[model samples]
Structures are given as structure tokens and as C-alpha cells.
Target: MPPEPVAGPAADIDSLFQRGYDRLYADDSTGAVRAFAAAVCLEPGHGEAWAALAEANGGGAAAVQAYAHAVVVDPGGWMWRVGLAEALRLAGSLNDAIAAYRELSGERADSAIVRLGHARALSVAGRPAEALAEYREAVALRPDDAEAALELAEALTGSGDALAAVELLQPLSRRAPDDAGLHHAVGRAWIALREPEKALTALRRARDLDAEDRLGAAPLIAALEAGEGADLSAAYVRALFDRYADRFDQDLLGKLGYAAPELLRAAVDRVIGPATGLRVFDLGCGTGLAGIGFRPLAGFLAGVDLSPRMVEKARERALYDDLRVGDVVAALEEVPESWNLLVAADVLVYLGDLAPVFAASAKALVPGGRFAATVERSAEEGFTLGPTRRYAHAEAYVRATAEAAGLTIRLMEHCTPRREKGVGVPGLLFVAERPADRPQIA
Candidate 1:
């Protein structure tokens, strides 16, 4: 009877799965995703369809979900598990990716690909020592793998072994002279070694070779040529903080002896005399350290930060009524006249120019609202970007800018907000108030 004419969802799922594979092979990922999605919807137990859907979507949360389903349905499918791990990594789920990779490594200890993926995830998660160990193992497994060698060299540079990174990268660069990434890595190693001229040459070559600017060499080149007034890029700051978020509190408080939050709180207390029931907004409210002190005084508490990971950490504190990932100046400008107190403890170091921030803060505050902040102090005439890539503003500049923004200076005192390299960093704690009778800025 010609196979009794296949019936039910099983036959339909098979047809859809075949169609999905056909579309996937033809490079029509969107159509393939739709087909595979339909097949899985028809039969949630179909592991193969879920795997195909994951492959079609490539890498994202959706792919992560589909691969996860496939892993659940057919736990023996090693490739599906690997795909799920990679999808988690690509979706910025670093901790989960690390966990998945750990499982895979335990199962297949000799797989170089698994080792490399684990190493990359660890490196991005800011666990440099662990990442370095994995990279070394991956390289050992595949001694001739150039990419593995390059990753190890980059990790070496990150771990502060500049000389070692240079020794590895120089020969590697010679072997692949046309590779832009190799050149960029070489440039970074040279910069760490304090060989600015050599760094410039390699960076320029990388920039010339990479028309798309994928490696972000332009900003580094600018920082090298224009030392003092150059502002750090938002992307750089966000990435730096994202990597640092997990270890931030411990590192800053315990190791660095950070006292910015306590100092700022004292200054605010002196200015307003234990004021309570104020509408408070914490700018760059990293891990909500500043917010913890201000929370007791706030009738309403809100925060904004550039790094999403930092914002996530802050959210966990449950101190903020509202939390957002955004630029501080933009956040200030967005909700003018909404806040009675604006706190920016140890945050302005990322910005070289403070005029815009001062103006925005003035406008954001109520007529009698107070703006408090800590800034690293510089002896330069205006402001300068320090070797650490943080901006330091001279007291004269801070006073002049606050006045220009129509904010009345209430307090500007010298203080040490934090310790760096076992030495106290010179800083200023300033509190400026918007005039009670002055009209808000347009």
C-alpha cells in the first residue's frame, strides 16, 4: 500500500526537518530557523530538529535555548553540548559558559577545541591566571596551532608579562606578516613594554591592514599621540568594568583601600546635616557601594552606570528603586529637576572634560539640590589623563567649571579617596549646590 501513507506529527516533523536542512545548506538561515522551529513546535521531543534550529540561528540566546533543549532530549549528543556551551559564551553568559566548558573538559580532557573555548571564556570573565593555564594546555595539545599561540601571547600581555608576550608575538608576527590581529597584539605588547615608537609602528600597520577597525587600534593610537586631553572611549570603559565587576568590591575595598564612598557620605552629611527623605540619584553607582550609604537618606533612590555587568551587581544590592545602564551625563540630562541629591563617588575619573557633566548635574537637580563627587587631583592647569588612563582634574578647573555651570560651590576639600600601589591617591571631595532661587538651565 506504498508504506501506508505516513501520518501524524512525526511525518510532518521529518518533512520540516529535511526542509530546514536544505535551507540551512543553501545559506538561508532565517528560513531554516523558521522551518526547524515549526518542526520542534510540532514535536518538542525532536532532538535533531532542535539541534538544526540551533545551528541555523548560529549564536545567540535563541540558539542557546535550542541547543539546551537538544542536550536535554539527547544528552549523549556531544556536539550539541559543545554548541550549547559556545552559544552561552557568545550570548555573554560567561559563568554559565565556564561551567559548561568545565563539564565538557572533564568528559573529553584531550580535546584542544574544548580547551581553547574554555580558555577564551575564562579570559573574558577576567580570570587571567586560570585562562593562562587552559591556554597553555590547548597550545600543548596542538603545538602547531598559530591561533592558540597568539591567544597565549595576548594572555601573557594581560597578565603583565610584556617581555614574554613580545618574545612570542614578534616571531609569530614575522611568520604571518599580513595578519592584522597579530600586528595589533604586537603593538599592545610594545605599549606594555614602554616602547612607544615600536608600538606606534605596529599599531599603524594593524590600522592600515584592518579597514573595518575591528581590533579598535584607532583609540589606542590617539591615546598614544594625544596624551593629556584624550577621553577614554565608552566601549573601553564598559568592557573594563564588565571584566572587573565580579572582583570589583573585594579588589577596590580590601586591596585598594577605597574610601570614596565613606568620604563622600561624610561630605554630604556635613553639607545637609543628616538630611533624609531626599530624592537621590547615584551616578556610576558601581556595585551600589555609594548607594549603600545614601540609601538610608533617600526617599527615592535611583542609579545609572555604563557597564551592564556593573549595573547587574548593583541591582543585586536591592538598594535602588530604579537602575539603568547608561552614561552618567546622559542620565542626568534625561531627568532634569528630578533629584535633590546627586552622588558620583570616584566616578569622574573616566572623563577628562567635566564641563558637560557639571552643567548636566546642575540641570538635573532641584533648585536647592546638592551635587557631590570625588575626583583624582592633578597639578596640571586644567585636566590630564593619567598613566592609568583615568582623568585627574585640577582644583582650579573643578571650581571654574562648577561656577560656569551656575552651581554654588559649598565644599571643595583635599582628600585621599583611595590607595593605589600602596600610596594614597590625591583627590578632592566637592559638594556644589544648585542655587535655591536660580532657574533651571535650558
Candidate 2:
């Protein structure tokens, strides 16, 4: 036989599909999309072609539709399902993505990577318990998987099962002794378990390993050293806000059930007695959580956050007249004697020492202007840093600081702002006024 006849259209389509995959691997999404489309035209039944097109769709609705079609065409392909789940996750349909992962797991329950993906999806979807179970399954399948163990530990800690998380990571911690994240996880576990001394030791090691990456542990160490069990440093507070800045409203307010901003607003209404056309600056306003509460009371509203991402998100709400990215202390100093209302909700808990902040806020306010703030309750500790390294001043200390800064206390009361250790922590709300002739605090 001089020349052998080529196979059917399906074979031709397979060749074209190879070309498309090569294009995909070479980072030419558009070319790959075109090639894949051509392959699908050549064989009409090429499931991989549909999947390739879907992957190349780059967040387009048409791309998702193509992926859906690919899944329908080849419902048995684990690859297709994985691609679809990943695309959905990127599109921010976390719950839908999670459902896809679950479906994939049902089909291939023994796939360690799939199980790991499932766990990640669950964690992002805020189903930490389910995620933890999936992570455990993944670990059981492959015990030496460092990523699986570390991620599992994170989900466990985030879900408030720190002790269990520690157990999961204890062996890995011994092997990967120098991993900063591992040590940090151990420290967090100790902290959650209410063993401050142990937490201090582990967290200190974490910091020593990589100071930049392990920034949160410093505050926690300070808290332990200071003999305060329930205090955190400003750095820790900032880290908390930074990590949750994008999802603060949903995770903190929606999931964890917080209402600090609203509680502050109610307290302010009672003390200030409803005034119209008031200018309000929500200092430390991460993602405008407090701005929502200020909407009714404030005629002019502005917000500031240290994280630019938070400031951008706050701007998206159209609730702020201006949003600035800078340190709150600097922002306060820049706006000397301007705003009538300065509300710092859950802000002062970060400051181990309030003298500087008090002075800055005093300078920022107009004469007779009110500064309303919230602070987490702490037993008298004479200004020592706690394990969390955030300063929690006693009620008397806070009052003394405000008074020393030329702000006379107007209203002081206690309320529960948010939960700590599965229970609400007592917080104080104070509204103080800077007098006309502010006495200098030496």
C-alpha cells in the first residue's frame, strides 16, 4: 500500500485538539480558544474541545456556558469537572464551586488532589467543619502532603477547633521544624486553647524564624508577657482587619454575628441626641462596616483605613464622601480641628498605650466636638503588653487618657460589641468632648 487512508473525522479532531492544548500550554488563550473551537467543529463531539474553550473563556459568560456544555457532553471526565470547579471558584461563586467539587468527589472519592481541592473550596465557602473533614481525608490518603496538613490546620483554627488543628499538625511540626507558618499555627492553637505561656513560646519561635511573615505573633507574645489573658496588640488588630478586610462585613458581621457599629450608633444617638448635617469621620473604617451605621446620623461621611484594599471596597458602597489610605494616627493629625464627630469603633483595642492616639484625636476635633470610641474590657495591668501584643486598657485608664488629652468625658457605658472565645467580650463606649480652651497635657 503506497498511501494509507487517514482515519475518521474524530481522529482529525484529536489532532486539532492536540494543537489547541499546545497553544494553551504556551499561554495563548485566544489562540487556544480558536483552535479548540476549530477542533469541536471538526468533530462536534469533542468534549475536551469544549473544556479547552471553557478554560480559555477568561471569565466570559460564553466561556462558562461552553464549560457547562463540556461537562454535559462528558459528565464522566474528572478533568472537565475540575476545570469547571476552578473557573467557578475564580468567578466568586464559591458555593456553586463547592457543589461542583462535591460532585467530583462523589465520582472519584479517592483522588487526594480532588479531596484537597474540595477542602479548599469548603474553607473558602466558610464550611470549615466540612473542609476539615475533607482535609483529613486528603491527609489520610497522603500523609506526607505538607500543603494538605498546613491548610487543614488553618481551616481547623479558623473554625475554632484549634486543639484538633494542633493534633493534626503536631507530627508535621516536628519534621518541618523551621516552617514559620507551622510554628505560627501551633502558637495560634495554644492561644485558642487558653494556654498563653505555651502560645508565647511557639509564637516567639515563629517570629524568630521569619520576622516579616510572622508579624501577628509579636502582639500575642506581648500579651503573654504582660500577664493579660484577653488583650491583643494594635499590630494583631491590624492583621485581623487586613486579613478580613475584603470580607469583613460578611465574615465578621454576617457569619460571626457582630454588631459593634450599630451598637455604637445607638449609643451615640442617645448621648449626642440626634443632630442633622453633622460631619462624621469613621476612623479605622475597614470596608465601611461603621459607615453603614453612620448613614443615618452623618450628613457628610468620610472614612480611612490603613489597607488600600479596604478603602477601595468602602468607596464601592458610594457611602463615603472621601476614603483615604494612611495610618489613622497620621490621618487624625492631618485633620486638626475639623470634624464635629469622630467615631472609632473597635479601634482603640489595638493601642497598648492610648496617650498618643488620644492626643492625635484631640488635635483632630473641633472645640466641643465629640469623640466616641469603643475599647475591649481589660483588668488593670498597668500598661503591660499582652500575648496578643494589643493594648487593652482598663476602664479607669481609658477615662484618664481621654481626660488628660483635653477631652471631658460625657458618656461612658458598657456593651458587648463582638464575640470572643464563643462568647461576647465586654466593651466600653465613651463619648468625650474637647473643651474650648483645651488644657495642654504635659
Q: How close is every model to the real structure, measured as TM-score?
A: 0.58, 0.50
| lDDT digits (tens) for residues 186-301 of candidate 2 | 88877765567778878888989976853487877888788765444333343445556667777777555677888888878888797877889999888888998887777889
lDDT of 1 by residue, 386-408 (tens): 88878899999999999899999
* Shift of residue 65 alpha carbon in model 1, Å: 31
Model 2 lowest lDDT segment of ten: 1-10
Candidate 2 lDDT: 0.77
Estimate candidate 1's RMSD in Å: 11.8
* Cα error of candidate 1 at position 240, Å: 1.3
Clashes of each: 0, 14
